[model samples]
Target: MPRLARPVPAVAAALSALALLVAGCGSNALAKQPPFPRSTIQANAADPSEKPITGSPTTGDPVDPAFAVDKLRLLDPCKLLDDDALKELGKPDDAVPGGFSRCSNFMKDKDGKDLSITVEVGQTVTSEIKKADKKIAGYRSYEQVLEGSACFVSVITQDEPGLAFTVQIGYKDGDGCVPGRKVAESVVALAKGKNASRTAAKGSVITVDPCALPSDAAVLEATDKSPRVYPYGLHNCSWVGDDAEMTLDFRGGFVPKDDKFDSKQTEIDLGGVKAYQVQTTTSFPSCTIKWVQLRGEDNDGEVVEVKSAGPKKAEFDRCAKAQSFAKALLPKLPRA
Candidate 1:
């Protein structure tokens, strides 16, 4: 099983907003900022060219979340499945569905490769691109995942009122799926969003596990100089010198345009977590840190002990959250 460590990625430094929108092709929402690297114990990257590659899907943790990995199910191939499997995966198999087996499989490319993944959705969600089904808590199955051009489907069923069971099929575009991977991903993502909204309205526990969630990830971070943060989507980010606090400016996403950093005017609110932007001041530790702190229910259901080694309370608080989040999540991580 893979586990989550403390400290979220810097990309998640900001909060994902209900009003903000994520593209169906992928989950483009994260909170932490980038450019900061501290105490990071990571693994090797996924060999994009390996056959039957079995390794951690993610290589490093985002700056917003300094202590965790790419937990988001983004690019995960488990969104498409057939109708029969959807019912079996979400319900009891006391007598098993007569004719069909409960398992789902993926299609391969012409070169003869295992380039897909299949998953059954028993929940709803729209967090990350890979976890779109998770964010909404809708039922889906990823019947196949085709290398770069992955595809999947989400089905909405009502086995347990308010909770929809989804059969998902995930496959890649490179494997020859119509409409390409991006388009397929977009279709499933849209379904995930709709299901998420519905679940929220009904107040249902759409998803019961953490699949690298979006809403539950309140961010804090510093980034790596490489893979710089892209300027688009619902993101509120900045670049801070090792020890300077320059005035932050938010144009797109949620930060109001031209909003000054006044105590009342400037606030970093990400669902269950809120960072009151006090007056900007000189920064300590003259080093850029792309780190991610945690917030919301992502903080719960786990046993944790947060002992801070700090110079200031806020620093301790921020750092502590990041660390604790990772530590708490480690136990639940799946094998990459």
Candidate 2:
């Protein structure tokens, strides 16, 4: 999953609002926003005519069947970072789920230096594969070191022009690539043995395909044009039209509050549920509506977000469009 904006450490008002939101909420939750600096990984162009190792599913069979998008989605990311598998690296902390498709394990070396290992599955891999300079467990791999403190090692999983299983390591005291590559190797081995665990939560949004949520008619009503679907990571989907776009995101994070977005948010009722709406014209005219779908422990929970945006020159009510889109989607969500 992509990271959110940097968190403010001293938001007293935000915390106060969060307390009110979670007053009677039950446990079951979601969250994200990495503690480290953003990675500098960039994609490089690959030869268009060069055939991908994982052959086209339409013309032939995929070489790596286990890495297929469907199979990869069901595998629990936290389980992939097994303690036994990472024992050689250092003392790893309990794995924490960042989102549906990402997890992180924080560790300390014998010398007491900090290291963080994060694994993300089903990440879009396009031109990045062109830089695959090595191989891990028969899969083409790409490795890059950033400022000697962070490293990213990714293995191409499927070539429906691409998707990857990636491992990122942040080790300020030593060469991050060494541990990064080791973790990548361990993940590949675990995947080969079918040892990666799967999510067992009943009625989990993790199992639902985001692209399948909004119907064709609802999409047309929202964006005013035929939709082109784009699924981001495993939990977010977007419907793009000629002049407008709508996005639906299923995420785990702190309870939504008025001060969270740096703009005044209005509280609104959505089929008996409390929801927040915020409009921003910083880059373009857009409106966002978000509400808690399932409450988790503390102030965290699963959230459903709907956003609608259009070019500034287009004359339309963005907030009303977003509200309408959210109302249409609310009934389709599984009950907590």
Candidate 3:
């Protein structure tokens, strides 16, 4: 028999190393292959015709249900608290829907002090909870003080870390966070699926587009030049000119509860409508005025604000100028 050829140890070691290198290269090459584009998959998933009959398809690893706030679209914050809950919490007698994902419930004490609950629905809560000041009910928690009266308790959903909501509760004489947490708990307990239906009545301020409030002539009269309109959101607009600036905002929800301007505000009558005019001397000379299209309700009306650098190159009063624009714009506003 041919002498058994003892393989060279060095050569054998080299071969083994080479095989390992080849295996690693194969894995890297597989990794470099492009993954299926998520956008394409999402598009297909979105179309009703593409759903598989037997199993649900997903884009990636399933999200934790605790962090999911999408169901908020189906909920109305105003409906979360029953009469018993409301009474137990001092009976917030009014509910104001701020938007699709927010609401405020409030009542006033004998002293004209407000007791209120405000709720906001949010997603991406997991990250927020990671930095929470406390933990409650197996959820990340935090608190905030609003205007020195209200306490807000924010809780991250345990099933879905990225989903969360806040309950803002306050009584002028009581600890805000304590009530806030209780309300938050109740809200969570009541967070079952319920259809949310909302509508803005015709000829209402809620239906008006703030950017379209000013006419060309009104813009010229107020700014002394052509107006450049910038819409900040569904209910806010701004106009800019050479030396003038004006903003139209929706302040219905906040104006009713705020007393900050009660001492300085003066009324400006526009036809049958009443508006509050306030002059500010801080920062720059400016005037702000609010008019009611809908009163006694939250998020109810339009606020027109005008600002200038100072009294210069002017033949008119700053507040008067603001008032003039508001008056001119009022008739054009939607009528209820």
Q: What's the TM-score of every candidate structure?
A: 0.22, 0.76, 0.42
Backbone collision tally, model 1: 125
| Candidate 3 error regions (>4 Å) | 1-194, 254-261, 296-316
lDDT of 1 at 298: 33
Q: What's the CA RMSD of model 2 in angstroms? A: 8.4
What value does the lDDT take at residue 215 in candidate 3? 80
Which lDDT tens digits does candidate 1 get at residues 101-203? 0122333334443322223222221222233243222233232232454343333222111112223222333433332233234434533442212111121
Model 1 global lDDT (CA atoms, 0 to 1): 0.24
Instruction: Compose the digit string of candidate 2's lDDT tens values, residues 202-264.
Output: 445656666677777788988898866655555667787788889888765455343253357
Every candidate's lDDT: 0.24, 0.65, 0.49
Task: Report the number of clashing residue pairs per model.
Answer: 125, 5, 12
Would you list the rank order by TM-score, best first? 2, 3, 1
**All candidates in order of lDDT, best leading:** 2, 3, 1
* Residue 43 Cα positional deviation in candidate 1, in Å, after optimal superposition: 16
Q: In candidate 2, which residue ranges exceed 4 Å CA deviation?
A: 1-63, 192-195, 256-263
Better of 1 and 3 by TM-score: 3
